[model samples]
Every structure is written in C-alpha cells, then in structure tokens.
Target: MLLPWLVTCLAGCAVILSPVSEGCGPGRGYGKRRSPRKLAPLAYKQFSPNVAEKTLGASGRYEGKITRNSERFKELTPNYNTDIIFKDEENTGADRMMTQRCKDKLNSLAISVMNLWQGVRLRVTEGWDEDGHHSEESLHYEGRAVDITTSDRDRNKYAMLARLAVEAGFDWVYYESKAHVHCSVKSENSVATNSGGCFPGGAWVTLEDGGQKLIRDVCPGERILASSEIDGSGELIYSEVLTFLDRDPATWKQFFTIRTESGASVSLTAAHLLFVSKGNCSGGEEAAFGSMRTIYASDAQPGQCLLTTVTGELVGQNEEGRKGVGRLSRISQVNMREDVGVYAPLTRHGTLVVNGVVTSCYAVVDEHNLAHWAFAPLRLLHHWTGSAGGHVGDTGVHWYSKVLYWIGSLLLGSEHFHPWGLADPWR
Candidate 1:
C-alpha cells in the first residue's frame, strides 16, 4: 500500500500535537487545573467514529468481514473507518484481543498516519496473544498493545511511528528487538485499567422471567455470540459479536473482538455472558428517566401552574381538554452559589409530568439544554435551612444554621469555606 521512501518523507513531517480534552466537557469540571497550552491544530480533520451507526451493526469499522461460519482476520465497527492495513500473514498465532480503549488508540494512530501520508496503509505484525512468547510484564497479555511493521526494514520508521503513537494518547510506545512498533495504553480510570476487561472465553446462559426460565446454548447460524462491557447492574454499556466466523469448536473457543453499539471494537470473552429476556410484550428495557418530561411553568402561578402541552406526547390529557395539570407536591426553587445569591424563582417552580403523574418539581437545565426535573413526596426540616451560605455568626439563634456552618467549616476547611449548593431539598 506504499511506494518506497515513505519513511524519509514522513520523518520530517512531524507535528507537535497537544493532549485532547477527554474530561472537562462542557458540563463537567476542568480536569486538574493547569495553565493552558497552545495546541497546533491538525491539518486534516481528525477522524471521529460514528458511535450510533456502529451500535446498529455497521461494517468496516473493523478490518475484516463479519458473517457466519467464515474466518475474519481483522475487523472494526464499520468498514471504511480503518486507516491502517494489517499484514495478517505475519501474525500467525498472535493474540488480537484487547480492551476497547486500546483499540481506539490504535485506530486513532491509524487515522493520524493515514492522514499524514494520505493513501498509505499500515501493516500490523503482532497484537495480543497468550502464546507464552510475550514478557510477563507485557501489556499485550491484557490486550492493550500492538506491534506494526515499518516500510521495508526501516528502523527509523519504527522510531517515527512510536513518536506518532504517543501523540495519539497511547501511554507507551516502543520499538521491539523483533522489528515491530509496540504501543500500549494505560486506562484513564485506574480501577478499569487495573481490572481485567469483560469475562474471558466461556459458556453462558440468559436468565428469563426472574429465573423462572433460562435460555441456554446458542445454536450455530442463529448464535451471534456477543461480548459487552456492563455496568455494576450488568446492563449493556457496549456490545459486539463475531458474525462471520468458522464456528468450529476449535476456532470459536478463541476470543474474537466485537463492536459495541457505540461502534468501538473490544475483545470480550464469552465466559461472562448472561442475557435475561424480559418476556413477550414487556417492551424490552427502558433507560433511566426515559419517560419523564420537563415543562417550564415560567408563566404559571405557583398554585395554578399552567402546562402548555406541545407535541401532545410529552404531557398527559385530562377529562377536560385543558393544557395544564395540578401539582402533586410543593414547588421548590433551586438556589445559587454560597457567596452569590442569584435566584431562578420564576424559572424554577414548575409541575413535571413523569410516567403520567403530575408533580411539583424544580427544573435544572444542564449544559446540553436538557432539563432535569426532580420530584420527591417527602419534605423535612433540613429543606428550609439548607443553603450555600451558612449564617455562622457567633450570636445567631438558628441552631440548624450554626450546625451547617460548623459542618461546612470542618469539611471544606474554614479558610476557604464554601458550602456545596443544595440541588434539591431532599439532598
């Protein structure tokens, strides 16, 4: 996929790229505050994977085809997203399994290299394999690294590739004695990085109807064996499966990579699979706060909150065809900072329609413009006293306020005391 002398040309074409902001998103806080550094903007637009398309079974995000009873050497979420081409012939018995995070960094490098040399293909020689050949301390065993061959025995090309990989968020990149570019990733989150990714190769079953029935043994042809990273509750965070593979007992036992709905490919072992069917007519699973709707009663009086029900689906209808519903609880206002006392009095009080119940609630608009309406039936004494400002005057009569002042001083340090804002009265 390349004409000769590509390394010499690329050797001088280096760009000092800056770290991309992964955390500190618009609504999120700035990560480990430091002086801002000037970033050299990329020449070509950096590639971004289509997460939605990947989740719905897009092709080519992987390196190879996905079908039943066929061998796939390499694969990504969708077909066209790959920038580097691997020399599968070199990786005879090497392991290819890796965490999704690792694969993403690799793909990012491929994108960078491809953009740098506009049509050249990268050939990967080795990836994760448990053949007892890799070192005991190797990140390859955990599926966090890969080795790629440079053009026609060019050692400097290997060094250049290592430099490029490090710029793409890979924590470690080294040229091995065996002549391949090795790169590894230390996860941003410590726990996930330290812990081994999703369960390794095994047999599993899906629980149905509260363990009343269990579906076991996915037969071939219909069995799209899947691997997914699940949360503590075991809900799908991402999911991928090998569609085209020689499902012979010998071949299927080995770990195959899968692309989640998010389009990120990850190595998952079949050992931890446990799907639970919700039964017919159960409407499958509903995401959290899925049915809740927030209507701004900025104009409505506190007791007689008027709901301008637009699009009809968000709010409910009553015996009389009116647009508004009565409040289920007392309307509360979300307050401001400790030193500052800005208020959203009119904008705060509102009635929320959640799962067909009209409740008095306060709406909190997030960075993305989505409103979070909270509803609670109970009200306590702390609700009236909670504030970012604690009146801690030594002569104050309010014991609750004094207690809060002391608590804030103790926890936040008295010198720079600022009480955490109370989002809701319940908290």
Candidate 2:
C-alpha cells in the first residue's frame, strides 16, 4: 500500500516525504509533507493579540524518512534485495518516474556492473533521492538520478554500470564512494555525456501565453529576459515576441507561467522577489509578515502611509497576483491563535516585499509585485483555516483566479514551449 509504504519508508529511510495531513483532501498538498515528521505549531487560541510569520522549513533538519521514489523501482528486479528495503539504509534509485522498461534495464545494468565484484551484495544509496538541504542538483527531482552501492573490490563493476548506462541511452554515470554509483541523463543533446557534466538547457523556461516563465533559477544577478508563452496544447502559443529585455525574472520575485488564457496555474516564491527582484537591491529576504491573534502596526513610524488591509480569511485574487487568505483562524502571537500580519503587504501593483507564510514566499502575491496592502490589521479567529470536520473535497468553495492562463493539465506536454511563449493564435 502506498500509504503504509509511505509512512514506514518515511520513518525509516530518508527516502520519501512524510505523510501529508489528510484533512486538505487528495492532491491538496498542505499536510502532505515529503517526510513523515510533523511541524510543531501552536493551536489557534494559544497566542492571539499578536501577529507574525514563520518559514516552512524553519522547524528543523531533515528527519530520516524513506520518502523518495527511487526505491520503489529497485524492488522490481528479479533479484530483489528485501533486506535493503527493510533496513533504514539509503536507497540507490527507486522513487523516480522511470518507465518499467527503463527500470528493468537499470537493474540488470546495475547487476551486470556489480558483477565485477566477488561475494558482495549490491546495495544502493541515493537513486532519485532528493538532493539534501545543501545541493539542489540531482536527477532525482525529475526521476532521472540513481545511486548504486557496493562494499567490495569491484572497481570494474562501478565503471561498467556507469559506462553501460551511457551506452544504453542513459548518460551521466559516475562513481563517488567505495560503495556506490551515481547516474543520470542530460535534459537535451541526443549525445550522452559520460564525461560527467550538468544537465543540458539552462534553467529559464518559455510558456505559451505571450509570456515567458523563468523556471526556478537562483543565480543572484540573473535577469528575466523577455519571451513569449505556451498554448493549450502545451506548445509555444505566441507570435514571435523573441525580443529580449533587460528585465530579470529573479528581480520580480515573481514570474508568470501563462500557458493559456484562463490564467489558472501559477507558482511564486518569496525568493522570487527579494534577491531576484527586477533590479538589484539588497532587500532583506528575511523580513516577513505572519498571522497571529491580531495584526500589529509595522515598525514604520506613524506617518508612514500603508494600503489598508482586510482580514485574509479566504482565497481570492486582488491587484497583487494570487493571494492565499490563511486558513488558520487565530493568528495570535506565541503560536497561540493564527497570529497574522503583513511581513510586507502582499501588494499587487508594485514589487512583492512582504515576509509572509512560506506559500506567500513561494506562491502568493501577483506578477506586478504589488502586494494587496491590507486595509485592516491582521487578526486571528478560532478555526481560521475553515476546515473543521465539515468540508471534505467539496467544490462549493470558490476563489477568483489571478493566474490568467488556461491549463490542459492532462493533455499537455512541456516540450512544445519556447523561450518567449506560444500564446498567439487560439489563446
């Protein structure tokens, strides 16, 4: 069962993410953490009369959980190592979204490579496992990286696996320990590079909405060059607007993933603004807004003018791109009540500068960067999240969308897009 496997694996090996909380319903991924541990937070009534913000990962270090998908593929080999899966050891590569054919070939290839050693069972270490906290570079995120392990004199086996994988249409293969191997493929370039290089195609992405999407890139001074968009068929949907601009996507702390005219799918993060904001200013990435019992006036002096704010209790679209009204009720300070406040107001017409919940940091706020400044101060109420034993998978709740794009999530492939976009003819 994926559920038990998810739980045990998460608690044991650092493989997959922890079990997500079941309240939000399937695909609604709030509680669905990649690991099994829970975040220590205060209940709504604990600290009202205060307001603040907290980071998603500020809770603690990565707990040992087997949440990655790599290990799942490993069990398919005719020669399965049940013990490896049972133990809380690192995995080789089982969780990625690899096709079955690729999987069969991989197990055989790994075994064949391991054949170089004598009397030693092959154990895997980190195939498709997520890149740990420090290094976000891995084929694992895309289901392409695999880590194979061994404990004997099999240098030849190590070389054989890496070498064979490249020959078998898989490229990036290398050895890193007395007991393991790492292998992956480049995003493009038909010719594989066993020579050991990074994935092909730099990070920026093109959409089909007469707009360009800057896929998640973290370079400090990188700019968001102008581009077009993708279309309903997931193809470049725009007329040639390839003229590049001096704007940087990083600077906006905001970028659009417009593929159609409906504007439904969008992704944003705080870092998307701070260091990446259009120009360059050492704005504090850490300055933030949080929910508490009551909203407190910004540390700014009294004369400072601020757009008034209303209680953010539901999801809706305002001037600031897409905003998420927190579900927590009593944003009280001290983790008591959902103490809510504007780290920076989630303004929509200007640059995004609010220190908000991690989602605000990542997905809230609009493209203009202007936060929807609150007319009223932040406040917490009991059951702020509004999901108490009543609504389960109900579509009755509605929200205005700021996404401004259409998405054929089921029928689209990512390759049809380009640097600018494809939103030209039919949406």
Q: Indicate which candidate wins on TM-score.
A: 1
List, residue by residue over 1-427, the lDDT tens digit for candidate 1: 2222222222211110011122322334435453333333222212111111111111111122222223431321222234555554535434345556667777788776676555555666666545546655555544556777553545545555665665565545554444666665543222212111121223222211111111112221221111111111111111111111111121111122332221222222211111112222121122122222322222112222111112233243334323321112212221111111111110111221211222221221110011111111001111332321222221111222233223322223212211111211111
Alpha-carbon TM-score of each model against the true structure: 0.28, 0.23
lDDT of each: 0.29, 0.26
For model 2, residues 1-427, the per-residue Cα lDDT tens digits are 3354333322322211112123222465544333432222222122111211011111111112233444544422222443222112444334433433335446665554445445555454544444462144444543344566444535555554444444343333454454555554332211111111011112322222212333322121222211011100111111211111111221211121111111112222111221111222121121123211111111112221121112232133334223322121111121111111111111112122111211121112122111112100110110232211112222110111111111211112222121112111121
In terms of TM-score, how similar is model 1 to the real structure? 0.28
Which regions of candidate 1 fall more than 4 Å away from where they truly are? 1-82, 89-95, 151-153, 187-189, 192-427
- On the 0 to 100 scale, the lDDT of residue 314 in model 1 is 22
Instruction: Please give the distance, in angstroms, between residue 317's alpha carbon in candidate 2 and its true position after superposition.
Output: 65
